[model samples]
Target: MRKIYVIGIGAGDPDHLTLQAAKAIGRTNVFFLIDKGEAKQSLVDLRERIIRAYSHPHKRIVEGRDPDRDRTPADYTGTIADWRHRRSQVFEELISEHLREDEIGAFLVWGDPSLYDSTIAILDEILERGEATFEYEVIPGISSVSALAAKHRVGLNRVGQPFQITTGRRLAEGWPEGVDDVVVMLDAQQAFTAHPEAEIYWGAYVSTEDELLASGRVADVAEEIVKTRAEARERHGWIMDTYLLRRRPTTDD
Candidate 1:
């Protein structure tokens, strides 16, 4: 039987790789890589560096073309579902062809596999089709949310209060009910700008050398954040940022 590992590689820093993750890499016979093109080559380079640092000498790497999707689609949910289905097909083919029975293969995921990542779902989809057969395991790693809070030295939620983790799209829709502390991810719209009263602890490429951090009331720092985010995105041709927005207690509260 074939065995697969869905290993979380943490955010971006090489040091983010855990001992367990390294051990998994060492035991892996083949690594499946999805090429996201030249603009995001840094991601591929980082993975290569880790594989070189910890993988066995006989390890093999197989690359697959990442399926393209609209960055801003009219129907975001449906678009993502379609994109993921296409992506699963790609992974299915890669596993069926490159991975041999009785060998261990891995997909190195960014951040924890159970977060906003789709690797696990894709694997499940492949299995459901009765096509690819394998035993899979998930290895957790530090997420960008964890890295952001650690770098800023702020707790995600104030004592005993709950914090909600949500996407930028939902944050833009409105502040979530009953949660004053909200963590936002995959926010291309700069949704934090909408809440001028909230205090934001923001970081881009957290834990990496090119990391940037900012904090203050959104009213005071929203412009700066917008400008900086634009510049960073332009500089890297892509950006991954996460932030915590803590709304102050209002007079009514």
Candidate 2:
């Protein structure tokens, strides 16, 4: 039977790749990478750098597009389900062309598979439909949350406190109740505006030389971050950013 290995490549730093992830890449017969068009060539370039440094000669690289799912609808869950379905179709087509029953197919994920990533979900759907019979494994890599904390020199949570991981859309809807610390991702909406009472530590292209790091009251830095993010996206044609927000404790109950 064939086996699929989903390896997290980490946030940006190639050194963040775990030994196990590198080993999996080296053993892969066919490795698939996603291309978000020419505008985001850096992503593909970064993947190539990692493969060149670690992948063996026997391993072949295949490029594919991530499914484009409509997100304008309020149905976040349904959007993701449809997105995963489309991704599974792309994976099936790619694997059919190169994967063999006895060979190992690999995919390099951006950050740990368990985190906001949907690659594993697509694979699961494929397996559930009996479209593919393959053993699967996910090798964890450094997450953007860890990278953000390290870059900002702050722990994700305070002593005995809990934190939440959410997306920009939810934040725009409203701050989640009962969470003091929140790590926000996929924030195209600049949701920081909704939480004026929070402090923000934001980073764009973390761990890369072009990184932009800023922190201060969310209200103070919200516009700056929005403008900077736009400029950076215009200059680079793409951006991957994340931020941490902590609700300041007020004296009043």
Candidate 3:
């Protein structure tokens, strides 16, 4: 049976690559990647640097074009589902053609596979189709959420309290009930701007050289964050950011 490893490369910083991930890279026979086009070439460069630094000298590399999808689709969930299906097809084809029965292959994931990433799900879909058969394992790595909290030097939640992790779209709709602390990711919408009362610990491209961080009362810093985010996105052509929002306790509590 062929074996596959889904390794988390961490949040862009090469030093964030864990020892287990490095060992996995060294043992791999082939590395598979999805090229996200020229606009995000920095991401491609980072992945290449990691592979070259740790992967065995004889390991083969395979690349596939990322499927294009509507960035602002009316049906967001449906659109992403379709895109993931196309990606699974690409990965399935690559595995079938490149991986030998005895060889091991891998997909280097950004952050932990179990987080917001869809690589593990895509691999599962390919397996369910029964077109390719391989047993896989996931190696966890430091996620942007963790990196954000570390960079800001704040706990995700208050003592004995719970915290929620959600997307920017959900946060924009409304703050979640029963939770004072929320971590937002994939927020193209800068949803924190809606709740000006909360304190925001925000960071863009956390752990990388081009990192930018800002934290303060949302009312005071939201404008600055919005401007900084726009400039960074324009400069790099892409950005990956996450922020933690903590709502202050009220007299009722």
lDDT of 1 at 27: 97
Candidate 2 on 78-180: residue-level lDDT in tens? 8878878888899988887889889999888887889998888888888888866888898998998899999999988876677899999888888878778
Q: Whole-model lDDT for model 1 versus the true structure?
A: 0.94
Q: In model 2, which regions exceed 4 Å deviation?
A: 250-253
1 or 2, greater by TM-score: 1
Q: Please report, as a residue range, the 10-residue window in candidate 1 with the lowest summed lDDT.
A: 244-253
TM-score per candidate, chains pooled = 0.98, 0.94, 0.98
Pairs that clash in candidate 1: none
* Cα lDDT of model 1 by residue, 1-253, tens digit: 9999999999988899899999999999999999999999889889999999999999999999999999999999999999999999999999999999999999999989999999999999999999889999999999999999999999997776788999999998999998899999999998888889899999998988889999999999999999999999999999999999999753233
Residue 28, model 1: lDDT of: 99
Give RMSD (Å) of candidate 1 vs. truth: 1.4
What lDDT score belongs to each candidate, Candidate 1 first?
0.94, 0.87, 0.93
Error of 1 at 186 (Å): 0.6
lDDT of 2: 0.87
The segments of candidate 1 whose C-alpha lies over 4 angstroms from its true place after superposition are: 250-253
Task: Give me the runs in candidate 3 sitting further than 4 Å from their true place.
Answer: 250-253
